[model samples]
Each structure stands twice: as structure tokens, then as C-alpha cells.
Target: MPFLTAAVVLVGALGLVNLLLTLGLTRRMRQYGHLLDGLEPAERGASTRPVGSDVSPFTATAVDGTVVGLDWFREPTLVGFFSPGCSACKDVLPGFVAAAATKRALAVVEKGPEPADEYVEPLAKVATVLVDDQAHEAITAFAVRAFPAVCAVDSQGVITETGVQVARPSAAVPA
Candidate 1:
């Protein structure tokens, strides 16, 4: 009887420790999630990305190697982060390309040397695309947690909206 009671007490104490540990982990995760992912641009990046603040300003290059900066009151820009390494990016490329015909659309391939011919060649038809030299700038700048994500920014470089799994999106622009 004494041994059984001791065992029971030990089990109960172990369970309590586990419960406490779980709670502590949850709290830490909530508080430190940003450390793992990045800052909050507030839904400014992909849908999977964490959205914070209404807007974020960033500078990106064009396929033609022109530097494009998000302005406050100019025209709207649609930024798309894509990778040939990702299957979803390939799937969404068509819609993104189509949208570029009517609006400003960009795809980040990789920065430095131009992207592979296979990816950039097809995207060139529609997008004002560029390559991301920084592998995770989009994720950090906009908290884009998901891939094949899109963000819309106004002329002033204010991020208006973002979609995680959207094929086509509508954004209001000033005439």
C-alpha cells in the first residue's frame, strides 16, 4: 500500500509538471512567434504571412533591373513572391501574369544574377518581375508565412491588402 501510494503521487506530480510545461510553451510561442517568423506588416504579404501595421515600405528591383520603390501617393503596385522551387508559385504564375497586363505586378525570383531562363522567360510576358537577393526579405518585411503570396501597395508604398491563397484579387486605385 505504501509503495502504491508513492507511485500514485509520483505520477500525479509528473502530470502536473507536464501541464505546467505545456502552458509555459504556449505562452512563449505566442510571445516569441515573431522571433521565428518576422515582423508584422499586417497582412501585407501573403495570406500565410502574419499581418501587422496597415502598411510597409520596401524597395525592389525590376526584371529590367530598374529599382522600384513603393511610394505613398503614386500608383498601386502588386508584388508577388514566387520561387521555381515551389509548385504553388507555378500554379499562380498565370493569373499573376495576366494581372500585370492591366496593373503593376512583380514576381521575386532571386536577386543578383537574373532568374533561370525557364521561370523568367514565361513571367516576362506579363509581370514587371525581379529577383530577390535576400532569400527571406519578403517573409521578414511583410511576414509572409505562405508561398505564392501577393501584396498590393499604393503609390506611397502603403500595403493596402494581401492574399495568401488568392488567384485573382481586386484593389481600389486612385484615378
Candidate 2:
């Protein structure tokens, strides 16, 4: 009877230790999750470019190595920042292509020197495609912290709308 009671106590103590260890591990995991959340701009709630900011001064190099400047934003334009390496960028590309038919569109492909052969022709069919080496100039100017971002620029070269998703503005029908 004495030996059985000792064994029971031992098992109970082991169980308690496991419970405490699990609790500690769970707390540490939550802390790690919060730290990871801060790593992403969207998860950290960071502000991208504010609406009404002008993007006219920004420039990106076109596929043909021609300099595309602010004049491209003279009309209501949709500017998309994308990367061949980003899965999210590839996912939204079809929508970006669809939006191009309704508006003037430009796709700024991030991370130059990487072969984006597969994405080039499709994006070029709908928009002026530009390759941004290091994405320093255009990304910094537009305050784009994330790939697959889309912004609507008004005729005055001011950003009227912005989002991670590419969507076309609603058009008014003739009465």
C-alpha cells in the first residue's frame, strides 16, 4: 500500500510539471507570435502612402529601358507595385490585368536583374511594365512597403485611393 501511494504521488507530480511546462511554452509562443506580427507592415498596422500624396516625381524604367516619368500619371492612372518573387503579386495579377482595360495602368516590377520572363508578356499586354532594381526609387517615392499594392492616381497626379488589392473604380453610366 505504501509503495502504491508513493507511485501515485510521483505520477501526480510529473503531471503537474508537464502542465506547468506546457503553460510556459504557450506563453512564449504568444510572445513570439506578437514579435512576428510586428515584422510585416500590414500586421503592424503601418501606414502606407497617405491618400492625396502626389506621385508625380517618382520614376521607373520601362521594359525597353526608357524612363517613365510623372507624365504617365497625367490621367487617372492605376499604378501597381509587384514582384515576380511574391506569390501575392502573382495572385492579384489577373485582376490587375482586368483593371487595365478600364484605365491607364502601369506595373512596376520590383527586384530587377531577376528573370521575370513569364510575367513580362502578360503584364505588358495590359500595362506599361517597368523593372525596378532594388525598388529604391519608385517604392520609396510611393511609400510602398508591400508588394501587390495598387494605388489610384487622379489626373492631378495625387493618390486618390490605395489598397493591397487592385480594383477598378466604378464608372458612371450615361443617363
Candidate 3:
């Protein structure tokens, strides 16, 4: 009888521990995710040779074998990241598309190796979808945590603005 009681207590303890771990991990994720929203630049790179500026090297290709350089944007560039299957992505599509209509360069960064073209069609009206096959290197480097987020950069390859969701449907609208 004592052995059975001990076993029940052990099981309960293990359950509690598991629950606590899950909660802690969830909290950490949420905290980190918040960083994805409106991440302001701490410092600027050298003005002449900027790497992650308004026109940085976002390694994604175009349909006609033309490689796109994110850093090549001399105008304001807006970058959005989303999953193809995310419902929230669909919800915000119209707004983003409408906004992209005005921006000179608006690119959508994808998470998978599925090639950017697959997702571009859906977002074509408002964005130039690009692939972040590994996701972490490009998207995470931007510190984005949410499903649908936007970033804007200026001519010098400097990040000027970032938005969480549903701001205003105007690319003419600043980040």
C-alpha cells in the first residue's frame, strides 16, 4: 500500500514539473516574441557600407532567375513575413496589399523552402514575396516573433519603421 501511494505522489510531482516547464517556456517565447514588434535600431551601421539597412541583402530569387537584393531599394522598402497557412495572414492580406500598392518596394519573407513564388501570387498585389528558406537567419535576425509583421527601411539601408498589425492601409503611410 505504501509503494502504491509513493508511485501516485511521484506521478503527481512529475505532472506538476512538466506543467511548470511548459509555462516557463511559453512565457519565454512570449517575451521574445514581443521583441519582434517595433524593434527599434540600437545603433546604425556605417552610412556607406550598410549590411542590414534599408536595402540589405535579403537572399531570395525572382521568377525570371533575377535575384533580388533587399538592400538595393533606394526608395522606402516595406518587408512583411507570414506563413501561407496562417489565418491571421489572410485576414491582414487586404490591408497589407493595399498598403504595398503605394510603397516602392514591399517584400514578403517566407519561412519555408517551398520557394517564394508559391506564396507570392496570393500577396502579389501588395508585395514582392521572397523566401527565407531557413527563416531563422533572415526573419529571426529581424527579431520578428508574430505571424504577421511589417518593417520599413529608407534609402540608406536604414530601418525607419516597423508595425505590428492593421495600422493603416497606406504604403504612403509610414511604418
Candidate 4:
């Protein structure tokens, strides 16, 4: 009878230890989720180049080998930085394309080993689509660290708005 009592106590202790480990793992997972949420651009802490900063001068060849330079920003330009694999970039692409209706938007798509014809095609219709295969010069010039980011650049070359995604200007705001 004493041996039986001791065995029962040992089993209960093991079960308590298991419950404590599970609770700890659950708490850690919740903390990790919060960390991920904070990394999202919509979160206040997401990093971006400062507004009102001038784009660094850069020259890059477009997919068609057309030379593009700082002159691209001489007009009020809406520049989008995207990656082929980023789901967030794909989600915001149609809005980016529609905003390009004024002929003032440009998309710099980070090239990968796989062909991105489908993603590039739609933007090509309304915007100058630049496939960045080599150095990612444009991405460096704009200080873009995240995919699906947009900067509203003024005619004078100053960035007016910078965010994770382009906000189509309200009709009241100048196009």
C-alpha cells in the first residue's frame, strides 16, 4: 500500500511538471506573435526612411535596358518598391497600378531567380516597371528596407509621404 501511494505521488508530480512546461511554451509563443506584429509596417515601430528626405541620386537600366536616372523624380513620382515573393506586395499591387493611371508612378520589382512575368505584366500597363536583377540600385537610393513600400515624391525630389503601401490620394489631394 505504501509503494502504491509513492507511485501515485510521483505520477502526479510528473503531470504537474508537464503542465508547467506547456504553460511556459504557450506564453513564449504569445510573446513571439507580439514581436512579429510589431515588425509589420502598419505597426508604429516599423522602420522607414524619413519623410522630406531627398532620394539619393542613382542611375539604373530598366528591364528594356533604358537608362533611368534622377530625372525620373523630376516629376511628382509615386515610387513603389516590391519583391516578387512578398504576399503583401502582391496584395497592394492593383492599387499601385491604379494610382499609376496619371503616368506618375514607377515600380521597382526586386528580381529573383524565377521569372515574374505575371507580377510584372499588370504594372507594365500603367507604370514604368523596372526589374532590379543585379545591384538593386534603386532600392538603395530610396533607402527601402521592406517590400511593398511606397514614397510620394514631390516635383522637387523631396519625399512627401513614405509608408508600407501607397495610399491613393483622396480626390481633394492633388494627384
Candidate 5:
């Protein structure tokens, strides 16, 4: 009878330990969730370069044969990185075009298995377009880590804002 009582006590002690461990684990997970909630998209691993960084020097040939480099951004410019087969890139293309309509913009398209004509045709209307194959000079220069990354850069080549969509210029009110 004593042995049976000890066995029961041992099982109860193990159950208590398990409950305490589970409660600790749950509390830790909640703390981690709160920490993640405090982070911004950029801090959470979005692929675009962070704001306040300078655009690295790079020279790439646009479709029109223009040699584009830091000098090209003599005015505020919107730059977008894209890939041919990325659905997200396609979804954001129109928004990028609209945002680039009245601003200096550059579109860098990474070559994929499919043709880039789908992306090139419309983007060319609003921005200088570059189709990059092996030489990803422009892509590397922008520190682009994912497709469809966009950034608004100042004339001095410092990135002012960056995200999955171009930052539209605020409308000015006439005095």
C-alpha cells in the first residue's frame, strides 16, 4: 500500500513539473510575440535598403542606351527592383508606374526564364528601364534582397523612404 501511494505521489510531482514548464514556455512565447509586434516592416526583414542610406555608385545601361549612374539621380528619383516571373512584381508594377508618372524613376528588371517584355513595355513609358542578366550591378548597388523593392531617393542619392511600393510625393498646396 505504501509503494502504491509513493507511485501516485511521484506521478503527481511529475505532472506539476510538466505544468510549470508548459506555463513558462507559454509566457516566453507571449513575450517574443510582443517583441515582434514592436518591429517595423524594414526591421522585420523587408528586402529594400533602409532609409537614410546612400545609394551605392553603379553604372548600368538603360534600354535606351543611356548610361545611368549616380549622376542620373540629379533630382528626386523613385527606384524599383523587379523580376520577370514574380507575381508580386507584376501586382506592384502599375502602382510603381503611377507613382513614377511625374517623377524621375528607374526600373531594374532581373532576367528570368520568361521574357521581360511584359514588365518592360509599361515601365518604359514612365521610367528608365534596365534588364539585368548576369551583371546585377544596379541590383547590388541598391542592396535589394527581394523582388519588387522600391525606394524614393533624394537628389544627393540618399534613400529617403523604402518599401514594397514607391513613396508618392505629397501634393503641394498653392499659396
Candidate 6:
């Protein structure tokens, strides 16, 4: 029947249109992905001080009342910037604490509305903990642009490694 033929043609035409539309959307997604890949870290607002950069001069008191500054890095040290307001910071805390336990580490926590006890307690066990308020000095000194920023600084006060996650130092092999 002609009606059946017409219906078949209509269905085939709709299928062809759907295929074309899907292809167009996929092509657009690829184009967007390429565009995103071309963006810089600074452009994306995730840039942090690069490795080999010197830490800016700063002094602050840790929760234990010890004065901390660049001079405090007399040995290779792991430094982490965290915030109570950031969920990512919470996720990173456990690992940071574990890693800090084995190395000389400093943990800077940005003050939030709630008490800092949640962050300070565990961090203090493994690191010299500093709880900083607005425009946190330690955060500025390290030029961190994102929460949970971490770095390894050498004795000379130059950052040697910087990232969201740094490789944990391996334990020394006993002779």
C-alpha cells in the first residue's frame, strides 16, 4: 500500500535526521574539548607557584605557638595548604597526614566559620599546624590558587615539587 510506503519513508527520513543531529552534537563536543585543552592554567584560574620558585617571606605562629617562616625549612619539607570550607581539602587531608607523619611537614588551614579543631587536631599530630584567617599569610606566601595545594621544598627554600599530589618519599632502606 502507498500509505505503508509513505510511513516507511517518513521513518527512514527521521532516522537520517537523528543521525545527522547526533553527528553534529558529537562534532561540537570534540571542538569544545579541543578549545578547553588549549586553555592555560592561569586562564583556567588553577595556576600555582611553579617549582623552583622561592617562597615569599612570611612569618606565622603555629597552633603550638612556634614561630614558622622560610627559615623553618632547614631540611626538605612537605607543605600543604588546606581549607575547612573545601570538600577537596577534606579528601586530601588523610593522605596528607599519612605522608606528613614520615616527613617534616607543615599544614596551613584557612579559617572557616566553624571551629578549626577538626583540622587542627589530626594535623598537629603529624605537622606543625597553622590556622590562618582571611587572606591567609601562609597561603599567600606559597602562592596557592587552589585548595589542597601541596609542595616539597628543599632546604634552600626553593620548591622542588608542586602539585595536587606529590609522590610520598620512600622510607630509607636500612643497611
lDDT of 4 by residue, 38-156 (tens): 56355341234678788888888766666767786767788777787788888878777777776477778888555667667887777777785522887888887777787777777
Each candidate structure's TM-score, on Cα atoms with residue i matched to residue i, is 0.57, 0.65, 0.55, 0.69, 0.71, 0.69
Cα deviation at 72, candidate 6, in Å, is 0.7
Summarize candidate 5's per-residue lDDT along 13-129 as a digit string, tens digits: 999999999999999998889668766554633576788898899998899888889898888888888898899898888888887676778889998777999988998998899
Please report, as a residue range, the 10-residue window in candidate 2 with the lowest summed lDDT: 166-175
Q: Of the candidates shown, which would achieve the greatest lDDT relative to the real structure?
A: 5
Q: Give per-residue lDDT, candidate 5, residue 129.
A: 90
Q: Which stretches of candidate 5 lie above 4 Å from their native place?
A: 1-45, 167-175
Clashing pairs in 6: none
RMSD of each: 7.5, 6.5, 8.8, 5.9, 6.3, 6.1
lDDT of 2 by residue, 1-175 (tens): 9999999999999999999999999999988886676563543312248677877376667776667677766678787787777888878888877887566877777764456765677878877787646245677778887777887777777777788776443331001
On lDDT, the stronger of 1 and 2 is 2
Model 1 C-alpha lDDT per residue in residues 51-154, reported as the tens digit of each score: 23444445655668666544422677676767666777778777776666677666666432334566678777766656555434444555555667776766
Q: Clashes in model 5: which pairs? A: none
Predicted candidate 6 versus true structure: per-residue lDDT over 36-145, tens digit per residue: 87665542323357878998988988888888888998888888888777787788788888888888888888877666788889999989988865228788888888
The lDDT of each candidate is 0.61, 0.72, 0.60, 0.73, 0.80, 0.79
Ordered list by lDDT, greatest first:
5, 6, 4, 2, 1, 3
Please count the clashing residue pairs in each candidate, in the order shown: 18, 0, 6, 0, 0, 0
Question: What residue pairs are clashing in model 4?
Answer: none
* Candidate closer to the true structure by lDDT (higher is better), 4 or 6: 6
- Give me the runs in candidate 6 sitting further than 4 Å from their true place: 1-47, 166-175
